[model samples]
Target: MKFNWGNQHKPNLFTLLFLYFLIVLIVPLGLFSAYYALAGNTNQERYLMRQAMNMTTGDASTVAQALESYRHKAYQLSTNPLVVEILKADSLEAESSQSRKLYELLFTVMHGDIYLASANLVSNSGKVRVSTHVFPEVDDLRYHGNDWDMASIINQNSQVSPTASLISIQSHRIAENGRQVVASILRRVYDQEGTNLGYLVVDMYADALSPQVNSDHVLTDMLLVDTKSFYATSLVHPERFGSFDRFPALNTLDGNYTPRSLPSDTSIIAISPIRGTGLHLVGSLSSAPFFQSMENWLSAFSTTMIIGVVLALGLSYLFSRSIARPIKNLAKRMREVEQGKLESREVSSAISEFSQLEHSFNVMIKQIISLLDLTREEQAKLSEAERKALESQMNPHFLFNTLNTIKALARLHGEEDIYTITVKLGKLLRSSIDNRESEATLEQSMALIESYLTIQKLRFADKLTTEVYLDPSCKHIKTPKLIIQPLVENAIIHGLEPKVGSWNLSVRVERAGERISITVGDDGVGFPPDRLPDNLDELANSPHVGVYNVYRRLFLKYGRKLHFSLKSKEGEGTWATISFPDEEAIKEEMQ
Candidate 1:
């Protein structure tokens, strides 16, 4: 028996075609299928989050409705005229033991829970006539200590109207134990002519409110934080009192709704404010499940991808021996090219598709070499052009002599102001022309504005008062040099100088994220409504030279990301806004 290399060398076209179909079509289709699978999983996760948010919001609405219901019932019981008449009768006199009669009647009629701990009547003379809860002592009936506080509260609440009303956290004494419970809603009992008789207090219990948050199990911990004392009604035990400054839920706090990290290793929080009460209800839950779902999805996708890649490799090998041999030869040739040996190697195959691939490879190698030579020539041309542009701009000696001659001529005329102005102008122009850099720190721009204002002040005199406000954090921020001066010049010459009263010129710099804005405003007669341009081209036109120049410079520096806005009213004031992207924005341009 002998091995035959001649039989192995034979090529088949159909097998080569099948393997090519698998590489070019089937493999890409598999990748596309995987991408859509991942996308579907992502959408599913988002949908689940949305459903959770909706459920949480629904629970919040239910709680609010319950509180409203409690408030309405309390209001109805508090303002009943019969209740008021009895309390007023008790206040009038002892009246043959009639006070005791009225007390018993009141207790009998308004007895039982009614979802409240107790409902009671109190008189203006600081007496608790009757209460559903028993009195611990005679002083409890007196209620003398709470009269001033409760009366003041009743007097100030004007929103409480003719029928019934709610007071915000009424301070009341529960005479039985003198344990003060903060009441949420109260009603004033009045006479027929609306004279102050007494008040009916509906006592809601601290423990009774527990049912308001029945879905606490859904979240890790649910809490109610009152803005008044920053106290919690239902927080994790032992740490429920005082401000929740250190609570894990506070980490999730944002402008209103925030996410906070919990001490428990696996929790995340979502917090939102309760309306009217100014209390915040925070819900903390574990994110491990959400993350685990994502991980499992990815793991499944990775398994699928591995299966697909293995099937593709096996199919490429199994379909045709002739196609596999040519591919192996092509890979060897690629390795030769990678090793800096680009001399083309011939591939022998009777299969048409494999033969075509061999021909294409030879053509591609020749084209790549041609492109390399062309790229070298283009690089040389770009270098020469840059060098010539640099050389054409140099004439420092002639520039200095010309500046000196101008200074001499201005001084000879005895125009001291003009001479001083020319000197500063020359220095400014020289720095601007020589620096050529696109960016400068805010300090440099501030110095430029100060110098420009000095010259402008000499011309405008007492007509103008200038103000500059810059955020301390923006001191190191880089901006275009002389950017602010152009805006100030526009405000002074066109907006302020022509007006009467105080010609106020204010410049402000505000930094936010990867953007900075400089605003220059003036309390001057503003632009006529019809004269303002309708589009950006008009804003950057020659008619508004100073504004236009700055606009153009900002456009060159930051492109579409640099925003410009102008607002002016007929007689009130004018504002010119210049906004540009920061360093982070510059990096985005590269990408």
Candidate 2:
């Protein structure tokens, strides 16, 4: 057979196979290689920076625990009644004896914690009344006005009852040497009558926090900085104490772990604040080691990817041949089927999946023919059922009775207005019996209400008066049919029928924001408060069927998108309101 080279229906299988191989293998590999080359180094750096932050967070937690323990112990010593009495003594002899007793108490408390350098009870007169160390250094300590500034160090706002104060960390000068760091906790002492006696100070050496804040990694270093931007202690450079100009950005961070890039030596710094002490633990790590590991990983990955590409090319050729052969055979069979040759020989293939495809095509054609016959039969049955349903809904007896009543009214009254009312009554009865559609425009529903009220006005005469107020903008909105009529009927029967005097009924429709509300109110005998149901479920089994029917229909049609309410007072009045969202109508208008 001769091949038609210009035939648009025929495609060259070899060319199609090569294009498939490129899309399945080469394109994806090229995209992945480009992305890896662009983002590999940046992603690795972010991961390493996160690791450094995690290390600093763990170290900071340990230091915060240790400092909190010291604050609790200091609170106990400061509030002791004996210590307060000693600071308030009148005579020198009484003061001397109480001072000895206070010294014994301090020694017993400080015996377990060797890191505590000194504990002192300083009187308001600027005298060291009691202390763990005799002749402790107190001259260099700064005082604010008549009170020591150290008194503010204790956390006075602690949530614990009898609020414990915070421990303040400060650098104190020692004689003949440089300033040494100390964690000072101070609380004011009060007498039994709530009199201010003096202040208590507990000093802990800052060196005690060195081990917890120190990092063992060779490329990493840690430092502890106080809230004043002064170095409390340093594991890397001890001489940098009292100076924080090296890390100027350290003061800006809060209690969370934050990472910052350093210009010096291309290092990354992570800092986390220590709770209760107003200090931060800063960790720094050099980026050189992290970059070296990334380079090594890239070299090994590139070699592996090269081998993978070579293997993929060889396998792609074999796979393309296997897929292309079956597809070519299937296409030829499809062209035969297009020419109306339904009895063609089955197309066989070496591949199990392709063989299954051939079998499925044969079965589908037979099913399509059978379904076409079934579809015609179903259409005939559906049309017949629709006709029967329409016939059953149109009741001839109700229509005949309504027409006969209108004839009697026309003959007996002999009034021209009675003819107009009968015409409206006919329209209302016809609309109610149709039941072809479940929804009508707001205007159509209002017309039905107008016709029904016109007929009722003739029956009740001067005893009944009705008012209707419809917003011009909401006339075109759609609502469930017969919803308003039932509510109006219920209002007439239950609310206004039993009243002795003239009854007034009002129907109002208004649009507010995205919702439309309809209210039906009557100045008649209202419902008793105790007889009304609380919700729709309770209303289902109640005696009020018309109101409950309208509620159930609205709920089923709109779900939670609509609101229905009824309010009444026994001797005053009754009001029924229905509100539904107008979003769908607004959207249609915009379109």
Pick the lDDT winner: 2
TM-score of each: 0.38, 0.41
Clashing pairs in 1: 251-260, 252-258, 252-259, 252-260
Each prediction's total of clashing residue pairs, residues at least 3 apart in sequence or on different chains, is 4, 4
Among residues 3 or more apart in sequence or in different chains, the pairs in candidate 2 whose N, CA or C atoms overlap within 3 Å are: 154-165, 154-166, 155-165, 155-166
Worst 10 residues of 1 by lDDT: 255-264
Per-residue lDDT of 1-591 in model 2, one digit per residue for the tens?
A: 344567766657856786678677766767776676788777767876777677777778887887777667677887887776666772234346665666677877777764435666666665545566543445222343445433234223232223345455443334122324445666677777777666676666545565556546643667776655354446455445545656544443433334443323466677777876667777777777777877777777678778777877787778778888888777787777666566535778888999999888877766766777799999999999999977865676667677768768886889657776768877887787766888898899889999988888888988999999889989988887888888888888888998999989998889998899999999889978877677866877777777888888888877898899889998788999999889787687899
The models' CA-based lDDT, in order, is 0.63, 0.70
Name model 2 segments beyond 4 Å from true: 7-15, 26-33, 36-65, 85-104, 116-168, 172-182, 187-200, 206-223, 227-232, 235-240, 248-292, 321-591
Give the total clashing residue pairs for model 1: 4
Model number with the top TM-score? 2
